[model samples]
Every structure is written in C-alpha cells, then in structure tokens.
Target: MLNCHDATFLLSQRLERDLSVTERANLRLHVTICRGCTNFERQLPTLGKAARAFASHDPGAEDSSS
Candidate 1:
C-alpha cells in the first residue's frame, strides 16, 4: 500500500522518467483506491503544460506588445 506522499512523489517522478514495473503497478493500485491522488495524477498533464509555458515565456515578448 502506498501512502499519499509516496504516491504523489511517484506520480511526479513519472513525468520526468520511466517508473519500474513494480512502481507502475503500485501507483496504479494506489490511484484506484485514492481519489485525491487520482485527481492529482489527472492534473499532471495540465500542470506540465503550464510549467513548460511558464519556462518558455520571455518577458521581452510581453514588452514587445507595448
């Protein structure tokens, strides 16, 4: 059984690298039983996109509009 902290950590790590077979299995099982973690997992993609957008944003680009 995975705790919420461990589960969330795994969920975030998954986006950065591949999880081992056991890790995937454990996370899958944890997500099935934990609605909070499940929602967090679902939001990962949107969060990733937002992070990329923020990272790629240039302050100069905004200034160009003025």
Candidate 2:
C-alpha cells in the first residue's frame, strides 16, 4: 500500500515519465481507495491541459494584443 505522499509523488511523476507495471498498479489502487488522491488524479488531465495552454502563450503574443 502506498502512503498519500508516495501516491501523490508517483501521480506527478507519471506525467513526466513512464511508470512500471507495479507502480501503475499501486497508484491505481491507492487512488481508488483514497478520495483525495482520486480527485487529484482526476484533475491531472485538466492541470496538464492548463499547463500546455500556458506554455503555448507567448509574451510577444500578449504584447501584440495591447
């Protein structure tokens, strides 16, 4: 069983790199039983999308709008 801290770390790492089967299994199980982690996992995609959108925005583009 993964502690909340470990589970959260794994969840974030998964976005950056691939996890082993065991790691994926553990994270999946943990999130299913933990409400907080589950919500955190659910928000991962939204967070990623927001990050990508922000990264795609250029300072020059913003300056041009003014």
- List TM-scores for all candidates, in order: 0.81, 0.72
For model 2, state the Cα shift of residue 26 in Å: 2.2
TM-score of 2: 0.72
For model 1 the local lDDT of residue 65 reads 66
Model 1, range 1-66, lDDT digits (tens) per residue?
899999999999998899999999999999999999999999999999999999999989779867
Candidate 2 pairs with clashing backbones? none
lDDT of 1: 0.95
Q: Best candidate per TM-score, number? A: 1
**Prediction RMSDs, each to the true structure:** 1.7, 2.1
| Model 2: residues with Cα > 4 Å off, grouped in runs | none
What is the per-residue lDDT of model 2 for residues 9-35, given as tens digits with 9 covering 90 to 100? 999999889999999999999998999
Q: What is the C-alpha lDDT of each candidate?
A: 0.95, 0.93
Q: Model 1, residue 38: displacement in angstroms?
A: 0.7
